[model samples]
Target chain A: MSAVTAHGVIAPILVPLLTGTLLVLLRGSATPLRRTLSMLGVQLLLGVSLWLLLQVADGEILVYRLGNWAAPHGIVLVADRLAAGMVLLTSVLALFAMMHAIQGSDRRGRQFHVLFQFLLMGLNGAFLTGDLFNLFVFFEILLIASYGLLLHGGGAARSRAGLHYVVINLVGSSLFLFAVGTLYGVLGTLNMADLSQRVAALGPEDIGLVRAAALLLFLVFALKAALAPLHLWLPGAYSAAGPAAVALFAIMTKVGAYSILRVYSLIFGADAGPLAGLVDPWMLVLGLITLVVGTLGALASQRLALLVSHLVVVSAGSILTAFGLGGEAALSAGLYYTFQSTLVVAALFMLTENVARTRGAFGDELRAGPMLPAANLLGGLFLVLALAVAGLPPLSGFIGKVLILKASVGAPAAMPWIMAIVLITGLLTLIALARAGSTLFFKTETHARTASLPNVAKLVPVAALAGISLLFVVFASPIHGYAQAAAAQLVDPGGYLEAVLGAGATDNDADADTDTEPAKMAEVAGPRRTTVHSPPDQIMPAH
Target chain B: MEALIALVIGLLAGCGIYLLLRARTFPVVLGITLLSYAVNLFLFVMGRLSIGVPAIIEPGRSAYADPLPQALVLTAIVIGFGMTAFVVVLALRARADLGNDHVDGREP
Candidate 1:
């Protein structure tokens, strides 16, 4: 590839990293200066991400090798349709969330701009990396930055929630290491493209070990995505975090979903001999339970913030269920739904902050409050977001749900159950949000005091996000087409592998060359079959 | 060697889980630290316990030890250290602010 295209691939990661470093070096500067710097950097990031999305919209997978080292030897960043789309979404979310933070929350803590930049860096890095080990490193970067952001305002509740969030993630990080290690030990490669090829060629005895490693990786991701039974940490953390922080976190769960989709489809895909259908059954069962629990949690929640957090769980469940159903159509629909829910939930969080500001002491609690100043405008925004999140008509959420339902028709066994759970969750969400809405906005008590006016800067981002979500409805067909193409790319890993490695990397000779190393390890480690090597030329490109 | 490494990992994980389930914050922090140690060692051994082999490759050499896992383990160790430090400070802050060190930040 030429230098410009190469830069395009790495720009998403480099821009944020360099910006974060600059902000840290320029610490103690005026708050206005820092905010200006952050805004310029994020806006540039958004431009680059949009350019990348357009570049990859034609089914091209862009792979940039770091330091001129080839795929298997050096770290490579791959920007295919899925990765590019996610980066674009993240940039959009980051821009609005930063705007919201700049309105006030950035003043509450030191280095808020610096931490936000680093968090963006980590997020972009995670999406673009084509190596499994690099993913872990990026995950840490994001987690550490998130720890700072979560505790930014310095409250009792935030610190308490940050404690649980940090500890659980630490444990999850450990498990992630174990899983990567095991997979590396068995396969002798950490590059994702090479791993997929090697996995397909694994001998019978090696399947069990690889299967175990795959399942462990799934557990780590499940914890991150807040699937049922493992979702204990999400509600507490999201509910207690500052509104801007929580809004940005709307994309964080999608990272887990993205990883699951990437790893499962790429590594243990249909070509894998014994591991083809390993995670689908488990994902289906857990997904259904998560949907039920999330809806019930929303219904039973006493606070609006917690209710939105539960809706996040419900979105994750919906995406996972579509993934478990396992077809190109369903996967496409899941991607579309993922995009819709992320934007709407983020907007909802921002709206919650504004509504809470208007309620004075009532503060987002589901109790009677005085008439909110500008009740009509704020109430209208909340109504639109609530309707979208509840998957009602005339919004992208309804279209997304329709796509998922239509796609799942192929999976006869799961179609009925998935539809039932999804519709029920939608009804529950509508009821809960409607009740909270009326209690906060419509009900007026005589003795209640009026709160201060909401900030225009704060309100603008929420309006912008809601507007974009509505636009998704206006342009659903083209967006769904893009999602369909992205899902097709996901199902077929060969294009990605070719883009990362060389053109003929899929041939049997390359597989044989790498197979011998793992076979030798297996022989020394256990009673496993061994394969022979052809030559090194078939594997790595010479300098 | 494999059996011994597995035993050590199991022991560390067992202790980590026990402490993680405790009601107090300090033990939970310690639990995460121990678990990270176990994970780091686990990643290190993924290269299959070769001794006296150079990690770097030579033109005619065919038996160099794998260095990728070592690099990965090193990265994990640094991250784990940073995490431990941050969480310790966070625990201290929680204790100071909430006036209790229970993992939930309130007296149980």
Candidate 2:
């Protein structure tokens, strides 16, 4: 409740936005200066995000109201354990992505530093925003920056995949707006806390419409998360992105998963009157399918980049399945899995780039080539990342999967399916990655020309990320405890609701105004109708 | 009036989906544009389509159209505009580089 802590919530967002703007203005400046600035910016973001995470680590929900507006009427940024953790994860990922890009990828296009910073801004904002409309706005910002990054290298494959990525997201954005409109029209509010209160008070008649809106919103997030049937756009898009961009893009799918967890828990949680458990069945089934399909895709992919992309899909499936199982333990394990997968996949993307670069003429196509320079170092990094991603023993992936499986035991019906799909998928991922590793690194043949060693700068980031996953395994206890606390809060959103809407605001009062109105009220009242009304008492200040 | 608005939204979305399914990039982009238009209108209509209500809140006014959706629509419009511009340029580049406009970037 201190002023500095309140202001600290916004710092993660402001640092990146200001830095990106500065970088854009300094576009004419030399690359070294821009690189230095971006490095400083991401480092600052990491520091601030860690601070926020520490502040919220004790299960505190920090709500920052913009422009001194009260919770309902003005924009609010709520930082709880989940949001802060996500910001921390993003900043960490962004730092390494920045480092990798600085080494070489930045040279491929203009404003690489600026776009990367803006992408970070979008991500932090999306994680922090408490208003649904603002979430849409932030999503657009992220997608636009992603579009720029997707085509940074300027090749046929990038442009083609970027086209599909852009068009599909544009449609998704449209759908997002439609869903927002429907929710607003029905509930008469956009604030998460207010929506939760209102939604719980909704009568049976309004349940159907609300459910439809919720599902529509779910579809948008699912598309972003790249779940099955909606996942066609992901492999092409992620594989097409440059190494650095793909490393950062790894977190983008988590944004989708985060939204689903946040919105579903807030609005349609177990307490939700008629719409409780609405998404559970669908998410469970579809998530399993996504796992099956993604694993198959990974198995079938010949290119290392596509293989990593499919792994991303597999991670999504696992997280969604965990989410679908529905409990504090399951959700907490899912969160841990999310963090582990994001870091490992990001490292894999960077490693794949290095591996490809070291194989002259083969270019990460999973084919044998000249023995790469520094083969031992690159191979070691690749093996660690590959094992981590495939959920092998001694890595964080195994621990995360074990936690998820242990949690799924409570849901007997889903337990068997979740176990079967996850274990099977893990096995397939192991096979695919091992095959890729042997072909690309082990089965190497000599040629007249030797592939060059990867740059120290590029290799450092990959090593750092991989090292962190190892660190995660060593420090699994505390992180698991944190995830458990975060999941507990998610299940009981009272802390979040109270923090945003103020204490003493209960659903009983909300129910008084819960009489369902027909959609034709606009027509009945006519366009010109005017009447006197008094605004509700402003319970909270923006600043 | 509500029915009419719904019909329009449905029609636009349907056409947009149809165009989106086309093999060529131009039509797909066009499809996205149409879908965005439909979405913008859908957002606008969420404010309940009042014509004579002041856009700004008055001291004593209780019966005003919901203004929040207008703000949302405006934001959506600007975003859609920028996105359309980017996609158009991207499609043009794809055509020039790949020598075709197929969404998959190659001929059947």
DockQ value for model 2: 0.52
Count of clashes in candidate 2: 4
Looking at model 2, residue A467 earns an lDDT score of: 91
Model 1 over residues A467-493: C-alpha lDDT tens digits? 988999999999999999999999888
lDDT of 1 by residue, B1-108 (tens): 879989998899889888999999999989998898899888888877776766664576545566666788888888889899998999999999899999987776
Give the DockQ (2 decimals) of all models: 0.54, 0.52
Candidates in order, TM-scores: namely 0.96, 0.96
Best lDDT goes to which candidate?
Answer: 2
Every model: iRMSD: 4.2, 4.7
Off by over 4 Å in 1: A509-518, A521-543, B58-62
